[model samples]
Target: MSATFTEVLPARKSSKHSAIQWRPVTDDTHVAGVLTIHTDRASVAYTVSEFPTDWPGRGFLLAKETAGTDPESERYSVFCAAAGPWGDTCDCKGFTYKATCKHVDAVRALVGNAWL
Candidate 1:
């Protein structure tokens, strides 16, 4: 099935917000997070990292699945880079400190590179 992603922001911002919820739809579904996906019968919504909305109930997001031998499994390797239509992100200290990281560089090289 094809999936489309979307981003949503709160009507307003506030603190003390600590809930997430999922309500069933007749023929539609949406997942809200740091990114989102939409489908005929199921959809996912991702929040903006810059200014996140308050989750209405409780939920957990599984962004990736990796083997124990993978670098993702290393404590110091908490981040891997991503790039493309939805945008780009990396979670390493370099990314956090400098807003750039080798992981992103590697991804760009592997993909033949592009300017944003």
Candidate 2:
């Protein structure tokens, strides 16, 4: 049940990073997936937006990095659960803050590795 959702993939990204599986939480508004990103440097925090009440739809700007960087920046993107395909439009504050965010990047890497 929960264990399956929390399963982590093998390490990637220069042998310093790995993406753990997503954990599902039930909400009256939207279902959510929380993924943990592990790096040799530090632990990364991530969040996903509310999944729609309907099926077969994409969740966009739902993913975000909650912490694990200087001043605790944020990042956002999209992920496919049982809904449909995986896609993302990064809205991380880093662009405006003039910094790089690994949250969206991590999600992109995980999905690219077929972890979705």
For each candidate, give its TM-score against the true structure: 0.26, 0.48
In candidate 1, what are the lDDT values of residues 1-116, reduced to their tens digit?
34332222222122122121222222433322232222222233322112122432112222322222224422222222233412434555555775553333323332332211
Candidate 2 lDDT over 1-116, as tens digits, reads 55334334445443344545565555524434566666566665555554343445334344335556444435454433342223333455643453334454555544555444
lDDT of predicted model 2: 0.48
Per-candidate RMSD vs. true structure? Answer: 16.3, 6.2
Which run of 10 residues does model 1 get worst, by summed lDDT?
A: 11-20
Which stretches in model 1 have alpha-carbon errors above 4 Å?
Answer: 1-87, 113-116
RMSD to the native, candidate 1? Answer: 16.3
lDDT, residue 95, candidate 2? 33
Cα displacement (Å) at residue 66, model 2: 5.8
Off by over 4 Å in 2: 4-15, 50-59, 62-66, 78-88, 93-101, 105-116
